[model samples]
Target: MSRTPQAQTRTQTRKVRAAEPPLDVAAWRPAPFLPRSDARDPALIFVIAVLCFLACLTTLFVIAGDRAAGGWAAQLTGEATVIVRASGGETPDAAAARAAEALAGVPGVAEARALEREKAYELVRPWLGDVSDLDDLPVPRLVAVTLDRETPATGEQLTGALKAQGLDAVVDDHSVWLDDIRRAAGVVRWTGAGIFLLIAVAAGAVVAFATRAGLAARRDVVEVLHLAGAEDGYIARLFQLRFAGVAAVAGAVGAAGAALLGALLRLVGGGEGITPALPIAWIDLLAVLPCPLLAAGVAAVAARLTATRLIRDL
Candidate 1:
C-alpha cells in the first residue's frame, strides 16, 4: 500500500535508527584477550597446588627436624658419665661417692651426683638375669656429671681429674652420638632443600607447557591481535597475568592445606610433631604464607618467557 509522505519519512527514520549501532558502543569495555576460564584450568590448579603442598610440608618438616637435632646435640654436649670401679679396700658405693666429689671440684663441672644403689643394679639387671641380689654382681658404679654449658668439661679433662684423685674411672663424653646427630641434621636439611627446588622447577615447567598450549589453541586470536598492532611484549603480558592468577589461586589452596596438616601434627603429636623426631611449632605455619606469592611469581615468569618466544615465531 502507498503511504503518505509524512508516514513514509517516519518509517525510513525508524529503519535508520535500528540499523545504526548504539551510542554506548563507545563506552563498552573490552573483554579479556584470553578466555576468563577454561576446561583445563581446574586440572592445572590441582597439579600446581599439589606441588606447592609438598614443598611447604617439606620445609616445615626440615625446620622441625633441624631444631630437634640441635636440641639433642646440645643436651649431649653438656653432659658426661663416669664409670667408677672399686680398687683396693674401696666399696662400689664409696668409690662412686669419691668420684662424684672429685668431679664436683672440677673447674667445668656443674653438678656431680652418685646414682643410688638400686639404680645401678637396674642397669645390670638385664645382663645378670632376675637375681634378687645385685649388690654382689661386681658391677661398676656410675657418676653422672652435669657440665657447665659455657665451659663444659671434655672427656680428657674428666679423665685427668679422676687420675689425679687416684681413682679408677672412665669418662664417656658422648661425642660420638653428638657427631652422628649433627651429620644427620645436615643430611636432612640438604635433602629437603633439594626436594623443594625440584618441586619449584616442576611447577614452572607446568606453567610453561600451559602457556605453549594456550598459545597454540588461541593462535588465531593471537594473529588478529598482532594484526591490530599489538606488540609482542603486550601479548606476552596477557599470558603472564593469566598464569599468575591461576598460580596464585592454586598456591593459596595448597598452602592452606599444608598449614592445616601442620596444625594437626602439632596438636596430635603434642610437644613433638607427627613423630617424636619432629617437633613442629605453631610458628612453622607462617612459612606457608609465602607459597602463593612464590607460585604466582614463578608462573608469571614462565608464562611470559613462553609466550614471548612463541609470539615471536608467529
Candidate 2:
C-alpha cells in the first residue's frame, strides 16, 4: 500500500538532508565582515556615506550655535540699564548729567555712559519711523551702567539708590531677556539631541536591513554551511564583520565631510544677523569623535543579533 502524503514528504526531506555532505566545520571559513565583491556596490555605499555626512554636519552646527549663543549671554551679564524719565520742565541734558553724577558715586559702579540724543533717536527710529521732532518728543535720558564683574549690583539696590536721589529711575537688569535666551538655548540643545538620536536609529535600521538582504541573497551558502553542522555563531560573525566595515567607512567619510563643512562655514565672514557665529573649539570637535565609532559599533551589534536569530531557526 502507498504511504500517506505526509510520510512521503518526510522521506524526501530526510533523503535531501542525507545527500548533503557533513560540512567540515573547521574548513568552513566564514566570509570576513568586509564587503564581498558582489556587495561592494559603489552607488549604495555613496548614498549611505552622503546621508551619514549630512546628519553629522547638521548635529555639529546645532551644537556649535548653542555654545556660541551661550557665550554671548555670559559676556554681557552683570550689566544694568538706568532710564531717567524727563521731568516736565527738566532738559534731558540736565537730567543725564545729574544721573551720571549720582551713579558715579555709587559703589560697584564700573562705568557710566549717557546715550547721546542722536543715538537715542536712532534707536527709536525703527519703531517711530522718523525722529524729526526730537525735542518735542519726551525721550528719557538713558544711562548705561556697567557694574564691576566681581561685585555686580542687583537691580533692586540700584533702583533704591537712584530713587533716594529724587529721580524717577527705572533699572532693567535684563533678567527677563537673559532667561528667554537661556530657555531658547536649552530648546536648541534638546532639539539637537533628538536629531542625533533619530540619525543613530536611522543608521542602525539601514545597516540592519542591508545585512538582512545580504544574508538572504547568500541563503544557499548558509544552507550548505548549516548542513555541514557549522555553528550559528560562526555564520553570524561573517555578516557582523561585513556590516561593521561598511559602518566604519561610512562614519569616517561622514566625519571628514563635517569637518570640511565646518571649516568652510568659518571662512565665510559672519555679516550681521545673517550668519551664525561658529564655535570651533578643539574640545567640542573631540567630543563628537566618538559618534562615528559608536555608529559602527551599534551597526555591528545589530547585524550580529539579527543574523544569529535567523540562523538559529534554520
The prediction achieving the highest TM-score against the true structure is 1
Q: Can you write out model 2's per-residue Cα lDDT over 165-209, one digit (the tens) per residue?
A: 788778888888788778888888888778777777777777777
User: lDDT (0-100) at residue 246 of candidate 1?
Assistant: 99
Error of 1 at 202 (Å): 1.3
What is the lDDT, from 0 to 100, of the residue 160 in candidate 1? 90
Worst 10 residues of 1 by lDDT: 128-137
In candidate 2, where is summed lDDT lowest over 10 consecutive residues? 267-276
In candidate 2, stretches whose alpha carbon ends up further than 4 angstroms from where it belongs are 1-36, 270-288
- Would you estimate the TM-scores of all the predictions? 0.88, 0.81
